[model samples]
Target chain A: MRINPKTLEEVAFKLLEKAATSLPDDVKKALKSAYEREDSPTAKTELKNILDNIESAEKLKKPLCQDTGMISFYVRSREIENFVEVRKALIDATVKATETIPLRPNAVHPITRKNTGNNVGEHIPHIEWIYTDQDHVELIASIKGGGSENMSALAMITPGLGVKGVKKFIVDTVVKAGAQPCPPTIVGVGLGGTVEISFKLAKLALLRPLGSRNKDKDISRLEDELFNLINQTGVGPMGLGGKTTCLDVKIEYAHCHTATLPVAVYFQCWADRRASAKISLDGSFEFIV
Target chain B: MVEYRLKTPLKEDEVRKLNVGDILYITGTIFSARDQAHRRILEYAEKGLELPFNLDGAVIFHVGPIMQRKDDRWVVVSAGPTTSTRMNSTTPKLLERFRVRVIIGKGGMSFEVAEALKRFGAVYCHFTGGAGVLAAKNIKEVEGVEWIDLGMPEAVWKLKVEDFGPVTVTIDSKGRSLYETVKKSVEENLKKIYQQI
Candidate 1:
């Protein structure tokens, strides 16, 4: 089935707009739950204010965070006839969304520090395409906020150190990151991969819904254990000292060389901005949460 | 734990009285500066050039607001605090040269910046990060902007604010720092956790 470029652009713009102004249902639920579990008075107030901010942004149709974040598109598609058109549509939609949704002009040239103003520079809205067997195309759009993005870390450990070493690295990153990543953060851990692949997996893990566990029992156990250890550090909401420092911890792993264990830790602030959509050959699109 | 309503062009006494963890609802006027604006201010100080705005007793917010035109005037859509540590390299100079009494941002700054805050009789305040929409509600007006060439995020925004904060004093003039305390306590806990593992 061939999808029209115009239809794809429209769908992309809607996804970008929705991703900017509203928190996903899973993220909203997690924040509410965190607010209830938070023990510190300051943390509770911080959580309440964040919840209020989310509601106001949604109601007013404005961005939930000022940063607006760098746009990322993760696409899972079957054989589509208009693949090239789809790419162009995604780019055009980003420019249109910048003006209509009025996103902050976040794309800047590294050497000269020139802002593109339209949120589209060279590779500004990062797109990753994954082929699948499904007849329809599914796209997951996520915004990686600057505050949390700054805290991403990777460590190459010797295989002898094992899971215990990975745990310490993740915990230390969270500790040092502290209030910088804007706790209670959603932590994504990638283990057993090479340097770059591990980091990619770490970010991919964030696309998973909050509170969902890895299918592997061992990995899921690590997620649960790390979740508690991170929260116990008392970094709390906005790192103001509390019982609920981390809302969730997710782990994604890949096979690595026998000699090296590369672990990447990524954090997403509680804003947790993301949305998904499915597009059919008839040029129709449906938002999935 | 005390809540205080502070007006800008703040007095030394007003700044000195702030303790770590005190909630503040600051009013009056405040200027916004991120890393680039701060660097320019330091450069201006170096060249002995007169600044576009007065800095004495000023409260500088670390932010890059999302502004759009509304009814022929600029309105802030969202204006949350940026991380302050990124500006730590320039903050001590800004504090000393500008005599800024209050610095507001998210996450805490480093020891050097904290010490500068102490020496200058200033305090570092922290607003909730990513609560840009909530913060925008407190901004009553966009007075003017300077260094437009620095781009939106890097420009110096003069804002008129009223009861403009749901902020906490994270680093106080008396050498007390909530971030430092938290880090130290967390380190102690890490020791125990590591042993258990």
Candidate 2:
């Protein structure tokens, strides 16, 4: 049973709309817990406002943030019979979503700085493909705002410093970022790998649900330690000062060359908008929250 | 911290009375401008060109809103604050030339901008980051727009708002800044974390 292109387009459009208009359940839970744990009145007020905004967006069925963000799709499938058709359908979905959902046209020419006006441009609506043996196709959509994305960092450290070096780098990045990235952020750290891969992994790590731990024991422990250290910074919500600086720290790693340790950190502001769906070969689909 | 309701065309005395950490709910007119709009405004000033809108005693917002044209009128779908730090270099000049009373944005501006706010009798207020829907609900009308050639996000959107905030005064005319306070504390905490590592 081959999936129809129209069905793919419909699913993709729905995923984009869902990702933009609502907060995922895991993220909402983390924010509620943060609000409860917060001490400072200012931080509490900020958290309250955030919660209210989420409620308002859901109720109004509006885009959660003005910066609907540059959309990216992560696709996993068993086999691709026609890659071009699939890619075209995804682009068509993006255009339709932009008009109906009225997403802010975020894509532009990097050098010339010309607006594409439809949120589609060169290599945009970027698709990252992963192949699997599964019979159905899984699509994950995420919208990352410019403020938090601007705070992303990468460092090449001397291997002698080990995990100590990695911890220091992570803390330093968050501290320097301060309230700029919008505190109580979900910090995604990609350790090891090459230069580009490190940053990619960092962004990919952000796709994980808050409070989920890494499969590796050491990495999971580091995630907890970093989470605590970041919160201790007292940057709080919107950097006004409080104990809930970061809601969670997620780490993803890959083995690297012997002499170099590469670390990258990506931030996802509390909005943390993302959605996923699984499309069966018969054209039926189900959202995975 | 004290809470106050402010309206646009703000007076110097009212802005001067505000201090770091004060809360504000602003009404009246506010103009939206992001990075490109800032640069364009200055460029127009340099060329001795008349600006389409006035900035004197104005409330300037750092935002790139999502808007739609519904039949005959424009509707704000989402209008939230953008990071102000990106406008740090251009702000001091804008404050000097325009005497903008309030700067509404998320995150915070640089120390120099805080100082400029002091010298210019202005204040920097922080809106809740990513709270776009709440902001749109508060925005009552699109009064007009300017420099739309710069693209939708970069265009200057003149708006009329009602109780448009729960914005906190992060930097006041007195030169004190809540961001600076937070930064100092973060540094001290970072020292301890570094030692542990």
Candidate 3:
């Protein structure tokens, strides 16, 4: 059985619309907790404003952010028969959604600086595919804003520096990026992979639900330690000064050569817009969130 | 810590009176420009070419809003502030050449810009970065736009705003920078964390 391209396009458009206006359950919960835990009046007010903005955007069916962001797709599939059509459907749907959902024309040439005007340009809507034993395709769509993307960092430490160095680097990145990426921000820390893969791992780490803990107890402990270390910087909500600088810390690691330990830190603002769905062969779909 | 209600065509003294942490609710006309737009403006300055709009006593907003066409007219959908640091290199020149009284953006500017703001009697205000929907609600009109060749995100958006901000002064004409202060305090916190670890 195979899903028709038109149905895929329809599903993709619906996913983009939801990604723009709705907040995921886990992220909403995290924001509510941050608001409750906040102490400083200024920070508390900022959090309240952010929550209000979320609610208003939902009600009005408008994007929560101006920089609608570069769209990304992570697909895990095994039994999808028209794989080629699936790719084209995703691209076509993205262009269609640009006008319907009214997403910003975010793709532009780096050198000539030409706007594609359709949110479809060279390597935009970056689609990454992963194969799994599953019989259906699971798709996760995320809109990564510019301000938060600007705060991403990559650090290479000597082998002797160890995990301690990674912690220091992550904390330093958050401090240097104070108020720039919009706190209380979600932090994704990638450990051990080489230069390029480390950055990719950090970004992929952001796909994990906010409150979900890592399977590795040791890594989960590290995530908690870094979370506490980052909040200790006193960056607070919108960097105004508060106790809740970071909402959550997620870590992912891959084995690498013994010579160097490369770490990457990725930040996502409170907007944290992402949604997922499972696509079936009968031209039907159900949202994962 | 004062609260100000400023209108565009801002006066020098009005901007000079702002201090770090002062809140402002601004009204009137303002132009939006980001990284590429700033470069084009500076290029115009170097060539001694006349700018498309008057800059003297004007306020500049750092944004790349998402807009949609409705009833054959364009309307801003989400118009939140962008990071100011990206414009730091070109800002002092813009301030010096245009005599802009106020700059509204997120993220603070550099020490160089702080000095320039002091020299030019200007101030930098920070609007909440992710509050794009709220920001759009405050816009009264989209008067006009230019530099379409620079693309939508880099285009110069001329907006008519009314009581359009819950912005805070992050950099004032007195050379005070809230970001710098935050950095210092963060360093102190980092020191304590290092001891704990």
Best by TM-score: 2
Model 1 chain B, poorest ten-residue lDDT window?
Answer: B188-197
Candidates 1 and 2: which is better by DockQ?
A: 2
Answer with 2 or 3, whichever has the higher TM-score. 2
- Sort order, DockQ high to low: 2, 1, 3
Each candidate's chain B TM-score? 0.97, 0.97, 0.97
Model 1 chain A lDDT-worst window of ten: A1-10
Model 1, position A35, has a per-residue lDDT of 90
For model 1, what share of native contacts is present? 0.71
Model 3 chain B scores worst on lDDT over the 10 consecutive residues at: B178-187
Model 2: per-residue Cα lDDT over A119-149, one tens digit each? 8999989988888989999989888899999
**Global lDDT of each model?**
0.89, 0.90, 0.87
lDDT for model 2: 0.90
lDDT of 1 by residue, A132-246 (tens): 9888888888877888989889899878988899888888899889999988899998888799899889888899999899999999999999998888788788877888788
lDDT of 3: 0.87
CA shift at B102, candidate 2, in angstroms? 0.4
- How many clashes in each structure? 0, 0, 0
Candidate 3 reaches a DockQ of 0.77
